[model samples]
Target: MTDFRSRCIAPEPLAGLFCAIPHPTGVEICAATGPDFLCLDGEHAPIDRERAEEMIRAAQLHRVPVIMRVPGHLPDSIAGALDSGADGVLVPRVSTADEARAAVAATRYPPVGVRGVGPGRAAGFGYRIPDYLATANSRILLAIQAETPGALENIEEISTVEGVDVIFIGPGDLGVTLGALGPEGRPKLMAAITRITKVSRAAGKAVGMFCASPDEVQGWRELGITFFLIGNDARHLADAAGAAVARAREGF
Candidate 1:
């Protein structure tokens, strides 16, 4: 397993992409391209626990770390992802410190948080349970999204949450909530992004974002984000296929 939690806090930017295609083959394709990590899109895709485990296995074949973007902060969702051997989870729609706390809690096992014990794939099916449980609390990365006005308002408190690792910015959702979409709202959107990054960093947590392209990575990195999910498999396939058809049509 890649030590993805360590990568999240490293000074150099860690670039990643989302694997929303819901298949091990789709995950393997992205893994072959060599992203720093891949986030399984459980929140937006039709990925269920079984599919997620297969996807995790596919990424692990290439030694790529996998983090699931679970549908919610519920313990069941978090536990299922972890049991499948995902390196971490990204909990969406976190709007307060309490929500952030719940996310982290669900990722960890007692004394630290409420995560229950299980002899799943992460533990080598009971064989490595001792070691897996011993280290899981520190090993699993728990990132909570800062996408709503409530999160922006409580950025500091959320950043200060004890076990929260990364404060991931869901730009689209955040913009929608802030009424900050389009060119006219760009400034407002950026301001929110900047503030989240700054505060999270100040509290000693790494900041992450869902970037539209690689071009956006460095600009955000300069502002203190070190983790990024740039684009997704579907977009890549669509763009390449569309361009090929467009070029072919030019000859017609």
Candidate 2:
């Protein structure tokens, strides 16, 4: 029987991968490599229901928490990810409090949230001695990505969403909206991130994001960021692979 996860460190980095690679072994291999946490792309990646389960199992074995990023806010997909055993979930493009609440509801079961409860792999089935429900709500890291001009405008409202444990800054998408990343020294994007973090901390929620380097992380950390995700699987692999290829070609 596996131990129930009472809590997991939220993933984060200044700039990290969103892991597009398919296959459980690939996920497993990436997990073993250790790069903050893996945001399993249940949304864009070619992973089906069965493979999601396989990947979760492997993540558990490696003792690395996996955040399942659902394709959208669809109820069924959200329900499936939680039931399948992801440590937490990252709902993308969440621009409203209602959508954020819906995502939180999908991950929990009654009282705390609205997820259906059942003895399954995530709970170690009936084998799990300690009740999985004992602290599931606090254990589940509910995060919503604030990635658009709409979300930034509603940053305070979105940050106040109930059951939303963390607010992540999707700066890339937000950056384009405010025009080229360099202009105004990213004041617009910076303001959005700061607003979300400010409101979240005031409301007693965690703040996190996808940081590219340690400097970005340090900046966010100073801003009270906690459950951040550093990078993804595919980027790590691509970076390493590219360097290897470059080194090999250098002889030519």
The lDDT of each candidate is 0.91, 0.72
* Candidate 1: pairs in clash: none
Q: Which number leads on lDDT?
A: 1
lDDT score, candidate 1, position 162? 91
The digit string of per-residue lDDT tens for model 1 on 1-252 reads: 557788786645788999989889999999999999999999999999999999999999999999999998789999999999999999999999888888888998998788888789999988999999988998898888999999999998999999888889999999999999999999999999999989999999988899888888778877988889999999988988999999999999
RMSD over all Cα atoms, model 1: 1.1
User: TM-score of every model?
Assistant: 0.97, 0.83
Poorest 10 consecutive residues by lDDT, candidate 1: 3-12
Global local distance difference test of model 1: 0.91
